[model samples]
Target: MPPTKLAFFRYLLIDEMLRSRSRPFPTKEEILEACNEKFGVNSISTIEKDMAAMRLDFDAPIYYDKRQKGYAYQDPEYKFLSVNLSEDEMLALSFVETLLGEFRNMPIFSLFSVAVDKVLDGLELTKKLHTEKRHLQQAIQIEQAPYLKGSDKLGDLLRYIAEQKVIEVSYQKYGSESTKDYLVHPYLLKEFRNMWYLIGYHEASGEVRTFGIDRITQVLPQEKDFLPQEKVNFDAESFYFYCIGVTALSEKPAEIRLRFEPFLANYVKAQPLHHTQEIIEDDEQKGCLLRLRLIINHELKMLILGYGAGVCVEAPASLAAEIRREFEKGVAQYATKN
Candidate 1:
């Protein structure tokens, strides 16, 4: 069958079951299998999405009948709305669902994918949206996407934050490999480069600190009272706003200059390393000069070094000199090895 005809046929599966002529109220799995057998839309998850869209967008009166052990219309008289779309609209909808699926992989926005599925289902478009999206995903490439770890701790931590409770956590810092316990006044959760981090006030340290969720081994909610005012106040809008990765820089942002080789200049312009980046000068012969207002931190140094010889720190002679010294030490080790 052609795309439009295939879409209409899928609608018949759910609509036929909803009408009083109902032989048996079809379970989601039944509808899902029927569509899958006829059309190639697999996955029970997709069926839930379709139902969500059906209710939210088209006001399709669908409800589950416990006695029948399957779905039924709350109002038996209701009919599925006819939604027609041009080819462009179909592709756009598919792209949106694909993008949402990407965001949903992140611990923070994980539920967003379901919302996208509902949007597609409500439009009454069938598997064609996913068919287009799948093709697009295969053709495109996403480079060096950071992998997230420590999803196990996310659920417990979220509950602790919502309950306004202090928790005793056993955390193992990166590279330490040994877990240490601390009384934490949990404030917020942050995602940096796809990794999850917990921001809280360490009761023993009397200072705010961030902990990687992956590093946490245990979190036990404590009845020990805590006040909201006591929560870590970094004063910045976002915990990681000033710094890259999960760490925050306490020092004020500075005016720093950098010069990138001509070959890398255009790429840097298109994908800025930081939000404060500004073009100080760009000339074919002179190379690309850029300025940024940011704190100088360990992470900042690492980011600069990532470009290797393609980039150089220009101003704040101190920072430039530090880079030189590190390179000299690194070179000595390699030279000795040779």
Candidate 2:
């Protein structure tokens, strides 16, 4: 039979079986009547042939119950339609699996794996089909950050933040010898380039701070609640808009400008460095200059260095000087030692 005719027959046969579900026993005439009006067919031979074909193709356990003199599903667990995949679906499944496999240690990987399994199971795909499609090619690529090292303390900080609990943490601030004890109301957890940070409101200091998770030597959950004064009206995106890196200092943002080489200009243009990034000057011949109103922080400096000679900071004299000092320090490392 042609594809269209086969499809029509399958639709009618399935419809008849579904209608029989609620009833104790439905006669062939009744099943035929329900489908014949919709399909414009009344031949018993045609109906029988379609039902037999459906049973064979779908592997459905449908049979005629002799005592009831009506057709019934032999296996109660079997569904009318197998959630089997077409070629396209199998290819999509295979591609996603490969991409997820790259991030094997990520917390979300197991959840994604379980979800893929559920979808495949629903489609009635055999293990062979799944295995055969594993080699399917993936076009898009995502580069995940290197696995975090020396930060077993991050998991605990993340748990406290998720639970909305106050934590007493011992943090060694950069350049500070003494470890400061803080009663912080955890606001958010951030991971930037493998380094993790907890953004919270420090009660004793009466200030919002970003504490690197790696610097946290100890984390103790405090029973005392540390709710913000006005329920932290800060929107996370807007608050982090002009951050030098992940540390969005509680200072007014400045209009910071940076120049990029022609080759790197297009790459920067395609992706925004900050929520408020905009192109102030773009001359392919002279290179491109982009402006963003964000804090000048170490995180942003590292990002600029990642592009090496392709990018430069054109900013507050202080920021430019800092970059120069960093390059000089790096150069000093290569000098001959007496």
Candidate 3:
């Protein structure tokens, strides 16, 4: 009457078949004995029904063999079901995987490894053709820039954060002579430009701060724990929606407008800056205009500068002023030198 017992028998039988590929065909009695031995289920009728369901609908062929007088693989060359990703999807996944590796001390690496293995297994079983050699070579040649060290401690901090445990971290603040030890309740781990950051609440200050993992000289699990006072309402995706970088936001999210050179404009259109970005106007003869709604962050500033002369930030008085200040400072430095 119970369906779980039947399903269990079916799974056992199919697994045996897959594992015993080189062995002679297994008979009904052999399957029944194996199922009973493995799962303690003696229901033969349930096994029959399970096999029928698997063979009919699940594409698992459980045909009888004449030579060995038992069941064997009907199609040994069957393929596994796998999600076929496009070039862009593959690129995005590869990028994220590489970036996430900065946290080598994290327990997340094992989980990520399992998922990646499953995906690779499915693709390996089903893939009809290998990646083109020329394309693969080109992709390999496309090198990502080198990154800073200290991934082991980063990983440990991330694991501790995921467990919601308090961690004592010895951190060296930038431009500071001394290092400080603090009990931190880590909330999130974010990656930008192959660097790792832990967003957490400090015990002493009771304020949420983002700490660079590189600057965190040491991290260890603390017996003392603290709950988030304000529930840490920040969503990384929503919080980082506006700004070009990982800079914090004081104001509400805003819509930012930018003009890109025709060459870079089309590229920007194809590969959007953010999920909320859109092309407000397109005049190829002049240039293309893009509008993005996101939190203004330090990461965004670096990204804007990355485009060099190909793109210009056109709106938001605060952002424009910041850009002007940076450029004017550079100009002043050169002028004073002359």
Candidate 4:
């Protein structure tokens, strides 16, 4: 069956559960009638399975009362509840819903949109909870991020990737003046910092590489046969274990040491820079020394620079030199007195 139809059916079951919470318990026949009114069809088998799932999966206290000739709660006060949606879950979904607002008209997520709305309806949140969600959504607009023009192509790209097929991708790398087209073997998609990246085996390079979805101008199907990804052997899990962001790769990780000003010591203690960060030394006058085992890359450079004078690279002299050079260049730009 179509996924949307199944989603609507689930909605009908939730409606029936909540509707039963009222007086005058509803008969199975009445439940079917209500579902038919909204969706033009109903099935005894499907409804039976939904009821069973509700009981087994969610511990709903539903039972058939022969005296009322209807389905009612075995325990009168036992409310039919959706255990899936706690406050935080709803908030996360609301954020995703808002993020997806930019592409609501895209057919790729039409069924997904219906499913998300159905899940929200099933939650049956209180007015106060709903209001809190609305207020949080208003605090920031996730849809206002840099527009990714060919985002709608993600669904099709995913489909081709799942089938281990090749695709003609028109991708323009960062800082490039022109777009480049290539036959890429779609392998995996990754997301970081609210942006998506495609990890594909470039037919041109014979190696797996990362491409930002935002920079992909087009993804078209290839007439060539599917490429077996087993030979590529790129493990997505470990590929990014020692990296930040989705840019250049390093040959190997290094032990990076940094010292934070005494004033900012507590802040770094509470929120360390990386997972490998460790407090190796602490001094009131000399600042706190922390260590991290990761590649020195563009992201790490920007992160250290953002801390300004509060942080300094104490070890890995090369990394320190790189940061110092950038700072010097930055100072030179303002030295002109623009």
Candidate 5:
């Protein structure tokens, strides 16, 4: 007879107990207690019936040991479920594994790698395509940072965030000589462009601030608990909604219009600079006029400067003036040097 949904869960629980290192070879009484706790009051007879169904239906190698006085698996490595993937599914899995390579040295990466390996083993794909997996790694290339400083603090920061514990971080900003300490109520950790940043409510500043993890000198946990008001209730999407990159210069998003050359416009259309980007006008022979609603910040300026001569700012006179002055400065420097 096929197992019912509840019976299937009972089988899984029994299997876990049998294979568990710490609590292996669970007795009938122990199995009853565990099942009752989760599924609410199952009898010893029910467990026996479930085990019998498992052995008959799935060919489970479960047997009672007279000496051990409990049930155990004859084949220790046996699993109840067998996962089979389609050709397209395997290709997708391979691509995801390659993408995870970007986060290689980080603490989270190790955790993810172990989970992925377990999944591959469970699906029985590891043994079949071990050689192909290696080739895929070589064929698919991803940009990775040489070294990420302060990655060691990720574990501790994650713990503190979960525990709601206040922490004192010794941070040194770029171009600053001295290191300063701040009492921060860490809310979220964000990764952008291979760099990690901590978004937290600053006790002294009375506002939420972003700190570069790479610049953090030291992290010390504080005994004081995170106050209720100190919790800004941060939402990553909402916080960065109208912003570009890490910085938010203003609360409101400004209307930004730019005309891009034919070639660069195609690239911009494919890979937009911001989510708010819209194609205002598209001309095959002329160019493309794109509009974005984003806060004008340092990163935005740098991006605009990077596309020099290929892009022309149409709206926001202040932004246009700023970009023009930047180009003027660049020209003046080159002209003087020449």
Candidate 6:
């Protein structure tokens, strides 16, 4: 029979006792007393049966030492949960732990460190070996924005999301001197370009709105309960389906076609701008034509602008004109004085 939750916990306790360096081997009576204290009272016969199960089922190298007058592992290094990881896999795990360093300053993901440490401990990676593997962090650095604002609000917002609470927020938009109050039923917390945003149902507007976390001055106490999920009807996937970045300004998505220079086309093919992105045409002389169905927002515009002269918007004459105007403005700026 498979072990019950209580049975598994008893097995763990027994394993710890067997592996104890200072106490060494422990008597059946001692093991029973410890298990009984934690779980319900278990008899000495139960301990014997548990050890037998450990030996048979788990292949635990458990034996009774006559000299010590107690039960012990024949293999001192034996663990109930043995995790065998390849050297490469171990290094990858270490690299993942290092990647989490991006959120080290954020309190919301603090448990991630503890969880990774537990896995490393289970793998029995020596301190020196683990430290050496961590050198990969220095070799492959993850770029993180220094001193991100509103990071401290992550923990509280996460808690509110879990509890399904409605919150009142004091917000000030960029370049706006005035601060406004909002009653929001926060649904999802999204991150884009190292900045955080709260996607929620705005009670006053009776529609969904996106609020930048950095712009939020305060989250007031819960004056009202959250609206029913059915009433809110917020589907994060559907909401973001046609959207690029945080803003979903339009109800319908535009079919955007773009042409990239040959060299830049290779990079775009490898790392696509959107999930709906498709290579419509590619040629040695003509370059590449890419198609994307997306809502043309500030982020998409900025991304296209970042590519400079390498990319050209082919379809959507309005968007193409907008890009042309932007480029013309840039050229005009350069034509004049600095």
> Mind giving the per-residue lDDT tens digits that candidate 6 earns over 20-115?
988988999899999889887578999998999899989999999999999898987777887777878777787788777778787677678777
Off by over 4 Å in 5: 1-10, 16-44, 55-77, 227-234
Q: Weakest 10 consecutive residues, lDDT, candidate 4? A: 14-23
Itemize residue pairs with steric clashes in candidate 6: none
TM-score of 4: 0.66
Model 2 per-residue lDDT tens digits across residues 1-338 = 68567566655566456445567456668667766776666777766766777777777666788998887777665556557667787776777776766555655445677777776665656475467555443345667667654356655766777788899989887788889898899877776766778888888777777788767878899998668525756565566766856867656777778899899898888987777888989998768999888776667788877787787878867777888788888779878565
Residue pairs in collision within model 4: none
Q: Give the TM-score of candidate 5.
A: 0.84
lDDT of 4 by residue, 1-338 (tens): 79666755675565455455464677666766766766665776656676777788667777887887877667654445554576677677767766666556555556577776666665654444457657766786553445455667778878998887789889898899899998888877876665778888787787788888889988888888766667777766777788877664747988899899998888999987778888999999878999888877888889899888899998899999999999999899999995
Query: What is candidate 5's lDDT per residue for 151-206, written digit by digit as tens?
Result: 98888898888888899999999999999999998888887777889988898987
Candidate 4 local Cα displacement, residue 101, angstroms: 7.4
Q: What residue runs in model 4 are displaced by over 4 Å at the alpha carbon?
A: 1-114, 123-132, 135-146, 174-177, 223-230, 248-250
- The Cα error of candidate 3 at residue 231, in Å, is 2.3
- The candidate 6 region of ten consecutive residues with least summed lDDT is 125-134
- Lowest summed lDDT window (length 10), candidate 1: 229-238
Cα lDDT, all candidates? 0.78, 0.72, 0.69, 0.75, 0.86, 0.86
Model 4 RMSD vs true structure: 7.5
For model 3, state the Cα shift of residue 234 in Å.
3.2
- Model 5 clash pairs are none
In terms of lDDT, model 3 sits at 0.69
Q: TM-scores, in order shown?
A: 0.69, 0.62, 0.69, 0.66, 0.84, 0.87
